[model samples]
Structure formats: C-alpha cells, structure tokens
Target chain A: MKLWTLTEGNKEFINETGSITKFANRFFIVGMKPRYEFKELLTQCYLIGYKSLPLVALTGFIMGLVLTMQLRPSLIVYGVESQLPEMVGISIVREVGPVITALIFAGKIGSSIGAELGSMKVTEQIDAMEVSGINPFKFLVATRIISTTLMLPILTVLADAIALFGSYIGVNINSVTSFSLFFTQVFQGLDLNDLLPAVIKTFFFGFAVGVVGCYKGFNSNKGTKGVGIAANSAVVLSSVLIFIIDLLAVQIADLMGLNY
Target chain B: MGNYAENNMRLGIFVLVGLIVLIFAFYMVGKNKSIFGGNFELKARFSNSNGLMKGSNVLYSGIQAGTVKSLKLINDTTIEATLLIDNEVKSFIRKNAIVTIGTEGLMGNKVIQITPFKGNSPLVKEGDLLESKKVASIDEMLQTLSRTNDNIAGISDGLRQTVVEINKSTLWKLLGDKAAANGIESTINQMHQASINANAFSKDLEMILSETKSGKGTAGLLLTDTAFATQLRMALVGIKSAGDHANELTLQLNQMASDLKKDLDNSNGFLNFLVKDSLMIKKLNATMDNIEKGTDGFNQNMEALKHNFLFRGYFKKLEKEKEKRKTIDQSLRIDK
Candidate 1:
C-alpha cells in the first residue's frame, strides 16, 4: 500500500511538472507576441506597482523596525550595537528587503491578479474576449507580467530606502543616532555587489510572482469557488518561488564571487 | 481616460522616486568605493595578504578613504596590493605611509589601513609602493594560542609530577612519622617555655623599673635620698682632707730624712763615727764581750760572798739590819 501511495505521489508530481511546463510555454508565447498595449501595461503597473506601494511601504518599515529591535540584543551581546545600521542595511539590501517586499508584493499583487483573472474566467469574460478576437492573454497576462517584472525592482529600491529609514528610527529609539550618521554607517559597509545582485534578483522575484499568479488565474477552473483557490494558490506559489529565486540568485552570486 | 492619466502621473512619481532612491543607493555605495571621486593609486607589498581582498576598504587614520583595487602575487613570498585612494586625501598619504591589513571588528571583514607619516613629506605619487606590514591573522593567533596551551599543559604536567613525587618522598614520610612528630612537638614546647620565660623576665624588669620609679629599693634610695647624697659629699671632703694631712706627714718624713742625712754627714756624731770607723767598731765589739764576761764573774763573786762564813755573818747582819729597819718602819707606820 505504501509503495502504491508512493507511486501515486510520483505520478501526481509528474502531472504537476507537465502542467508547469505547459504554463511556462504559454507564458513565453504570450510574452513574445508584440501586441503589448502600453495603456494596459500602465494600467496594470498602476494596479500592481503603484497601488501596492502604501502596503509595501508600511510592511517594509515594520519589518525593518522589528528586525532591528529583534537583532539589537544579539548584537549588543557581541558589543557591536554600533554596527546596527550597517549590519541591518547590508541585510536588508542584500537579502531581507528584496525578499520580504517581494513576498508582500506577491501576497497583495499576486492574489489581486489571480482573483481578478479568476473572476473574469469564472464569469466567462475571458471567453467572450477570445470569441470577439481580442487577445485576452496579451491584455491580461503579459501586461501584468511585464509590469511586475519592471516595477518590483523599483519598488524594492524604494522599500529598501523606507526600511533603512525605519531601521534608523528604530536605532534612534534605543540609542541617539543622527540620520546622516546612520546613513553614513549604512553606506560604509555597502558595496555595489551587495546592491546590484539583490536588485537583479527582485526582477526574477517579480517575474515569478506575476507568472504564477497569472498562470493560476488563467487556468482556474470549478467556477466561483475556484477564484478563491486561484488567489490562495497564486500567493502560496509566488511566495515559494520568491525564496527559490533568491536562493538561486545567492548561489549564482557566490559562483561569480560577488558575495564579499 | 482621466483615471488613466492620474494613474500615469502616480506611476511617474513612483518611478521617479524609486529611481532617485536607487541612484542615491548607488551613489552611497560608489562613494564608499571612491568611485565618484578623483582617485590616485598606490601600491604596497606584503609578506602575506592576511585575508585582505579586493574592494576591501582602505582606511586612513580609521576613516574610509579608498578601497583595495587588486591584490597580485609578486613572488612566492610577497603579495602586492593596489589601493585606489580619493585624490582629496592624497596629500595626507605621504610617501612614507605604512599600509597594513586589519579586521573591521573582532569577526568582521578585513580592511587595509594606511598609517600616514608625519611632517611635510612628499605626497605619495600614483603607483608608488608604500611600506606594507603583514597583520597577524586569526588562524595564526589561534595557532600561537594552541602552542601556548600546549606549553601550559606541559608545565602543569611537570608540576603535577613534581607534586606526586614530593608526596611520595622520604621527607613527607618523615613528617608523618610519630617520633619525628614528637620531636617537633617537644621543640615547639621548648620554644613555648622559652617564650614564657622571656615574658616573665620582661615582667620582672618592668616591676623593678616601677619599684625604682616609686623609690622603694636600694637603687631607688640611691636615686632619691638627698641627705645620703650630702653625707657622701661630706665623706668625700674628709677623705680629701686626710689625704692632704698624709701628704704633709710624707713631706715632714722627707724633711727628717734629709736632716738625718745632714747629721750623718757631720762625722763627729757617735752614730756617724760608729758607721764610718772600722777600729771603733772593733773596740766596741771587744768592750761588749768584756762587759758580758765581767758581768758573769761578778755574779759568781756575789754568789761566793753570799756562801762564805765570814762574809756570810756580815751578810746575815746586814740582812737582819735591813729586815729590822723594814720591821721598824712598819711598826712606826702602824703606831702612827
């Protein structure tokens, strides 16, 4: 029975792998088609990037503040509390800021894209667009994927700034540090390698989030209840993909000897 | 369309802000790398790089001034590190500057430190080789610490062995022996007795001093009695006077001896003649012998006269007359 269960699990894994490949093919095909509506892309950018900023900014600030507060006692134990800004800055820029902000973006933008597309699929709006000879995938999936791919890095930069500012405030709450000094210390240990690789990885994070969300939503089934499932699965899958991309980015950066 | 315009404006603002932050981040990181500044290169040769990497911060007096450009091996034993320093701080880094590798914190990144030379030495020219010092790395320090720990272990083992051998020694056994212990005890007791005797002696001396202070002993009387002192003075004066009289008697005896010598020198004196004349001495001796013989014959004649009959009657009458006279005198005294 255990062997049967294992075999079934293997089959399911193979089926999921096939579905993923099909989704990737469709995503690439849709990406390659030159019917990119700048208007639609702008609209999706507005929805996915600009609309999500406030929440991302808020989460980024709280994440930085809480991270600083949590890391303080450990650094104080090592008597390196003076290194808080630099340490936190490197962590946020190199790893935390991009990953956390992307995760948040995944949760907010991914679920929104999934739900909206899933609803359109459920209501047969996508079907109508297809019958009317409109390229729904171009209007819907490609714009979002492009917008996310472009916007996430920008958002990550902004989030990293806000989070560093939050960390400065957090530092000032315990110790007395001026903004200029905090920024100076934050920049002192930082190099282009630390910033560039992390920023580059966020583009991938954004792509993963967008592709997973659109894939789940575009292929959503079961009608009304499938919208919630699509939204949930999109967030879950995108969040997981964000970490995988980060891990791959780190490994690549290590191979390139950029992780000094 | 209005909504799209608003969204576009918002997107523009968002992208613009993001670009500004990204630029600022790049600027800050570039500034740390001395990328945005006019820079000069300097080189240093070291025996060991000590984990100093390319792009590690170059510090001047603990302030970030530049970054390490590259590290290349010059030979089997030496590594040459190139530093890109900001041109603004070029004057401060002189030709005599010393470059050494150091760590950021206890466990932080390695850094290259440039110690500027004092005085108006010439500025370090581009590509000039500054002096390099190899810092001790953590591994080296740990190896030294490990050697020290092994030495400490060796010393402690020796000490432990010494202690164990001492514990097993004859001296230690002797200390534990009853007879030796008794001897030590007796010696200690003798010392205790001596200490007690000394204490008693000091007490007795203290008592004597106290008695002397209170004028209770002979020494105290000698010290305190003023009348006795006066009598002593008087006795000393009398002795002095007697000594003077004895001196006068001695002078008188000397004068008598001189006068006797003068009398003896006047040869007419009988003692002088007897001392000077040998014939007179012989006559004096003959006269003394004749006197002695004559006295014996006289005493014999007197005895014969007392025994002769004629003489005896006369002698008897004379004796009777003498006796009668004595009786008559006695009767006269008794009658009166």
Candidate 2:
C-alpha cells in the first residue's frame, strides 16, 4: 500500500513537471495571445506602482527619518556633524534606499501576487482555464511575474528618491541644509562604486520577489488554507531570498573590488 | 486605450529619468577624476618614488595641479611616474620643476608636489623626466631624534664624570680639606717665632747701629755713618768703573800672556832664560818661604794686639756709645 502511494506521488511529480514544461512552451506561442494584453501590463504597473505608492512612500519616509535619528549620534561622535547629510545621503542612496525599498516591495507586491493567484487557483478559475485549453501559467503567472519583475525595480528607484527627500526633511528637522547643497553633498559622497553595486543588486531582489511569489502561488495546494500558506510563504520566502541575494551580491561585488 | 498608453508613457519617462540621474551622478564623480574633461600628461622620474601610487594628487606651489596617472619601476633603483595635468595649467609647470612625494596632511592621503625653480627652462614635455627629492619619513625623524637625545645623554654623562673626577682630584682636596686648620696652626707658630726672632734681631741691630754710630766694626760703621755710606757708594761706583776698565785691561793682559808664552816656547827672544831656569827655581823657593814666615809672625802680633787693653777699651767704648744711644732714645720719646 506504501509502494502504491509512492507510485502515485511520483506520477503527480512527473505530471507537474510535464505541465510546467508545457507552460514554458506556450509562453512563446505568438498567434494565441491578444495585442490588447499589453493593456494588462499597464494595469499591472498602475496596480503595482500607483496602488503601492502610499505604503512604499510611508516606509521610505519612516526608514529615512529613523535611520537619520539613529545614525546621527554615532557620526557626531566622530565630529563629522556637517557630514551628516552627506553620510545619510550616501547610505540611503547606496544601501538603505535599495534594501528598504526592496523589502517594502517584497511585503506589498509579493503578498499581492501570491494572494491574487492563490485565490484564483482555489476558485477553480485556473482549472476552468485549463479545461478550456488555456494555459493559466502563461496567462496569470507570467503576467504577475513579469509585472513584479519589472515594477519592483522602478518602484525601488522611486522609493529611494522619496526616501532621500524624506531624509532631507528629517535632516532639516534638527539641522539646516539647502536643497541644492544637500543633494550636492549627497551626490559628492556617492561614487559609481557605491551606486552601481547597490542598483545592480535591486534587479536580483525584484526577480526573487517575482519568482518566489509566482512559484509559491502556482504550486499552492489544499483549499482556503493553501491560499493563506501561499501568501505567508511568499512574503517569508521572498524576504529571506532578498537578504540571501543581497549577501551573495555583496560578496561577489567585494570580490570584484567594485564595492568597499 | 488612451489611459493605458498614457500610463506606459509615464512609466517609460520614469525609467528614463532614473537612468539619466544615475548616469549624471556617475559622470560627475568620474569628472572629479578628470575622466570627463580634457587633460594633458606630464612624465616625471624619481630615484625613489616612495610608494607613490597612481591617483595620488599632484600639487604645484601648494595648489592642486594634477594627479599621478601611472607609476612604473624603471630599473633596479628608480621609478618613473606619469602625471595627468589639467590642460588649463600646463604652462605653469616649467622644465626645471622638482617633483617629490608628500602627504596631504599628517593623517591624509599621499600626494606628489612640484617644487618650481627660480628661472624657467623649457616647459616639461609629455615624456620628460623631473628630479625627485626625498621626503623624510617619521621613522627616520624619530631615529634622528633618539640619536640626538643619546648624544646629549653621553655629553651629560661625560660632564658628570668630569665633575666627579674634579671633585676627587688632589687640587680640589687641597682647597677643601684640613689645609685651613694646618695653615692656622702653622701661622700661629710662625707668628710666635717671628716675634721672638724680630725682638732678638732688633736688639742685635740696635747694638750694631749704636757701635757703628760711634765708629766700631767695619760693616756697622758703613751702615750707620752717613758720610761713610756716601763715601762707600762713591767708592763702589769708582770700583765698578775701575773693574770694568780692569776687565778690559785683562783682555789685553791675556793677549800679552799668550804672546809671552809664544816667546818662551820659542826660547829665542829675551824670555829664553825663563824657559831654561833650573837654578833660579831654588832661589825663588827660598825667597817665598822667608816671606811666609814673616807673614805668620805678623798675624801672631796682630792677634795679641787685638786682645790688648786698648782693644778691650774700644769694645767698652762701644758699650758706652750704646748707653748714650739709649739715653738719646729716652730723651726723644714723646710718650715719656
């Protein structure tokens, strides 16, 4: 009876692999898809970018404000009070900006993708599409994956900019600095060494968020509990992957002597 | 449809703007390294480059002129560095300029400074080599300071030893020891002796002067009588002159003696008998013995005469003269 159950599990694994391959093959099928599906990309961008803006902005602002408040005393100990803006600007642009923005994106967009897709799977919408010979993976998973993949980096860049502005506001709360000079000091402290590695790492962060969210939601099982598992695991896995990818990127960049 | 297209356009614009800003920032930082601007190259060679790396700031007259573009080991000994100078200030660097590695500040980055010479030669070309001066290292300075301190310590030690030696020397002991006590004792003894000797000598001198004042002994009379002293002085002056004249005559006498000896040795002149006189020698000895007996008889009579009453009376007269001197001294005494 255990041998019979093992055979059933193996058969299910082989069937899943076979369908995943079919989905990949259907991705390039040109004639079946509508040109108006491009509208869906825009809608995804709006939903991802515009809908998530408030939370991203709020997180960015709080991150900037709190980081400045925390780091200010340490920098002051070094007698570099005038360099606070420049230091904060460099940290925000190079490290904090990308990382905090990516984590926020992971929290907002990752769960959104997971829940939306997981709910669809549970409601038999995915099965209906499959029964009609429509590839649900290509339609739903690909769109959400592609949307997160593209949207996250853009959102991160916007979030980084807003965060720096929020840091400027936080700086002015206790310190006085002009807008142009603050940015100049910020940009002066920034080098290609700091900027390139940080920006490059954000792409991997976005990709991880998309892939992990899509993978979890698509492979989700059970009933309503499966959707909960999908959403929870998507966020947890994406956050973990974000840190993992960042660590690896830092190591590789350090090995290349691109970042110090 | 329009809304969707417009949203896409906005996204595209956002992406473009982000890329542009990132690129611009990179360009600004790169331009600080003179990567974006036009620059000229100047080469300089140094015997010891002192580990000056590429991208070290090059300064001229305390102002930033360029950066060290490359450093290469020329041989077993020397290093050659290429400086990327700002094109606008190329004319300011003359051929005779000296380049040396210096630091930005005590805790700052390494930099190369160009020390300009007095009169300008031709401007340094792209590959021209410049002279290098050695920068004193902190370790070397510390070593020199330690050596100086060591030298000072040695001198102080030598001085201390010299002072110790001086303190231990006989001269210092003589100055500082029981010499004062010895001196005091000896001075007291000498003072007592001198007082006794002085009293005795004064009594003797007083007796002699009294005797001489009444015309007694020869030396006493010569010392006490004023006329005798004057006559003795005149006689001495005359005798000195006579002695000088006699010495001059003796020189002539010596010449005469030498002439007589020459004549006697020849035995052919008037002195021939003197050279041959064997019988005359016996006659001369008898005459000399007779003269000696007469002198001995005269000496005996003189001694007897000195012990006679008149001689004793003369001594008694000298004692009376002393008595008279004592009376005169008493009469002349104002305190009495």
Candidate 3:
C-alpha cells in the first residue's frame, strides 16, 4: 500500500524470484511434453508474431532511418559516407535489429500476456481451467512461450531486412544509390558471425520476455489493481532483461571469437 | 474458422519470405567467399607476404578471380600462400603467371594480384606453385624513405657548413677584419679602391688636357702657341750650327797638328829645327833665358819708373788703361 518498506521490498523480491524459478521449471517441463495444443499454439503464434509485425516493422524502419541520419554527419567527417551501407548493415545485423525488435516485442507481447492472464486470474479462469483438469500451464503458458521463442527470430530477420530497406531510403534522401549496389555493399560487409550470433540471442530474449510476463500474470494478487501492476512490471522487467541478455550474448560471442 | 485460416496464411507467407531473405543473404556471403563456386587450390611462395590475410581477395587483370585459401610459413624467410581460384578464370592463369601482394586502397585491406602470362603458355595445373614477386611492404618503403631523407639531410648539412664558412669569412672581411686572410671581400675592396684612384687620376688627366686645349701652362704653350714653338725651333737650329762649327774647328786643329808633325819630320820649318836640332835648340834656350832676364829687368825698370813723378803720371794713365782693358776682358769672359 505504501509502495514498499525496506524489509517488505526485500521479502517481496525473494518471493518473486522463487516464483519465477518455479514457473521456469514448470514452463520447461510442460514445453518438453509433446501433448501440444496445436490449434491454440498456432493461434498464439499468429497473435504474438504476426499481429506484432506492423509495429515491429515501423519501429525497425524508423530505428534504422534515425540511426543512419544520426550517423551520417559523423561518418561524413571521416569521409566514409560511401561505407554507410556496410556500416549500417553490420550494426543492424549484429546488434540493432534484434535488440530493438525484442524490446518492442517485450512491450507489446509482454504487457499483453501479463494483463490478459492477470485479468483471467482475477476472474478465477485459471482456477476453473485447473479444476476442469485442462492443464492451463501447457495450453496457456507453454504455447505462448514456445510461440515467442520461435517467432522472435523470424521477426528479427524480417525486421533486419525492413530496417536495411529503411536505411537505403535514408541514404537516397541525400544521395543516389542503385538498389543492387546498396544490397551488394550491405551483404559484402556482413559475415556469418554477424548474422548467426544476433539471431541466436533473440531466442533467449523472447524466452525471458515470455517467462517474465507469465510469471507476473500467473502470480497476480490484490485483485484488479494487481492486474495493472503485473502488466507494468512485465514490461519493465522484460526491457531490462533484454539489455542484460544482449550484454551476455556479446560477451559469449566475444569469448567464442565470433566477433570482429 | 475463416479468420483463423487467414491468420495461418499470413503466418505462412511471413515465414516463407523471412526464409527466402535468410537464404539469399547466406548465398551472397558464401559466393563472395568462393564457398559456392568451383575453385582450384594454387600455392605461391613469396619472400614477404605484405600482410595478406587468409580471406583476402585474389585478382587477375584487376578483376576478382578468387580468394586466398590459407597461408603457412614455409621457412624463416618465405611464406606459402594457397589461393582458391575460380575454375572459369583458371584457364587464363598460365603456368608462367606471376603473383604479387598489393593493397585494396590507400588504407584498405591487402590483396593478391596475379599477372597472367602472355600468349601460348600451358595452363596452370591444380596445386602448382606460381611464380611470386615480392612487393615492398609499407614498413620497407618507409625505411627506404627514411634512409633517403637522412642522405638528403646529410648533404644539406654539408652545403650549410660550406655556406656558413663563406659567410663567416666574407662577413668578417666586409667588417674590415684582417684575420680573414682568404676572404674574397678584401681583394674585392682593394680592387674597388684601385678603381676609385684610377677614376681620380683620369679626372686629373682630363683637367690637364682641358687646360692644354686652352693654352694655360708651359706644356699648354708648347702644345698650342705657334710663335713660341717657332722661336724654340730657331734656337735648336742655332745650337746645331754651333755644334757643326765646333766640329769644323776641331778638324782644323787636328790638321794643324798633323802639319806640324810633318814639318818636324822634314826638319824644314824653324819650329821643327827648334824641336829636332840639338845645337839650334841650345841656342834657342839661351836666347829664351836672356829674353826672360831682359823682361824681368824691364819689369824692374817699370816698378822704378812708377816712383818718379813724370813716369808716375804715365804709369797711372797706363794703369788706368790696363784696368779698363782688364774690366773689358772680365766682361767679355762673363759674356762667353
């Protein structure tokens, strides 16, 4: 009620961490059993991945356009404006495309999952599903987690392509460049190291976002007021986790000598 | 059901497009790396590799023909480079082809450049070692440039020392220091002073010449006065006549001496008899003695007569005449 006292915040933090661990264990165990609700998983995949495309694409496009515009004056100082495609391509493929798309996914999907499940929990729908013996964790949580894990990589790849197209347009606003030459420069500057490591890390980002959302919503309390808190905390936690995961991915890539 | 079908279709389309993009990207990267192309491995041995890396582009005639496959140190001084050349361009790379390491741009990556041999050489077989030309590395070029700069600096130092020596000596001499014994300035200054003196002497000569033209001095009169010149000419003529007359008188005197000698030899003249005849010379001597005595006696008589009154008047008149004659003779000698 008073937000938190020191002792209460510490106690709540410990409880949340324990709940996340138990939820993660249940999510993996349920994810492994092959009694997947195909129709529900498909519907969730469509909702999580496809419904999020336009927002992801728009944000991806603007992100690339703004990045290129901001980078232009600095690169012009170095007289390397001709290398804009290569530089922008490498940056998007290795870092920007995946991270930004994942953050957007976290905001849109993470908040949605938390609020939807939180309201259902407040309405006693999760209890009803459990009483009916329908395995709500698998049907609700596992499908969403699996859908997010699968969809984010696909989304990232699409977002990266769209962002490069946006960067191309950004390049053309000031200078003329043939599309073939632009793409060639972009592809020439990228290696498997840039593409594979970035794509691989989005799986973890999707998992973290989904787990945080489900953990918040599945443990909702304090009635309708807790529903809003769950959604807010899901977005906040998933965003912070995205940066942390990105940092760890870079370190791992660096350790494996995959980064140049 | 219809909405679900539509969503599934959209998902399928999205996944398909994403896959195509990924496949295309991978294919482009693989093609550039020569992974998808049919390539043959060829090795070249070089003394220096010039920082050429494993994935560096291989070029033939300024076009991309292949990529470097691997590099190994063959020995301490040589590097063995394996190149994967595209099979399509392999036929053009003859057995005599030359490989050299070069750079992409001024600050770009290193590349391997192959020069295909001209006409009718056998094609290079797979794994055949091509001829390699060692290019100068940036470090080597910088070292040679630094050595050349050092040589130029040394030469400039020598020239500066020579210039400094010249300046020290010449400047000292200009300030009138005699210690700069070999200074050119001193000789130049002496020549300058001599020129100034010559200019003054010429001016003096010009003044003398102008005065002579105006008939001002002795030389001016000699040069300009005709009357004075004529008088000088007459005096010179008179001197010449006097010299001729004196020469004539000497001839006459010599003739007289010869005539007297002839008379002495003939013993016909009284002067000859007086000189040659002993008995006549004796009588002549006696007569001269008597005459001398008589003259002495006459001088005594004159002295005695000077004391007498009547003779004193006569002697005074004679003395007066003698004095007058003596004065006249002295005047004549002075005139001569």
| TM-score of every model versus the real structure | 0.70, 0.58, 0.70
Chain A, candidate 3, TM-score of 0.96
Q: Which pairs of residues collide in model 1? A: none
Candidates ranked by lDDT = 1, 3, 2
Q: Please, what are the lDDT tens digits per residue for candidate 2 over residues A1-260? A: 99999999999868855754564455436314664355566677667766676788788888888877787888789777677777887788777878888888888888888887888888888899999977676667666666776666666666777777888887888889898877776765666677778878887788778767776677777988999898998898789888998899889989998764
lDDT of 1 by residue, A1-260 (tens): 99999999999878866886677677688766786688989888888889889988998899899989999999999899999998999999999999999999999999989999999999999999999998888888888998999899999999999999899889989989999999999998798999999989999999988888888899898998999999999999899889888889999999999986
- To one decimal, what is the Cα RMSD in angstroms of model 3 from the true structure? 10.3
Candidate 3 chain B, run of 10 with poorest lDDT: B173-182
* Residue B66 displacement in candidate 3 (angstroms): 3.3
- Candidate 2 chain A, poorest ten consecutive residues by summed lDDT: A23-32
Which rank order by DockQ, best down to worst? 1, 3, 2
Consecutive 10-residue window with the lowest summed lDDT within model 1 chain B: B265-274
TM-score of chain A of each: 0.95, 0.84, 0.96
Q: How accurate is candidate 1 locally (lDDT)?
A: 0.90
Regions more than 4 Å wrong, model 2: A1-37, A50-54, A82-86, A130-134, A162-185, B45-69, B86-106, B111-133, B137-336
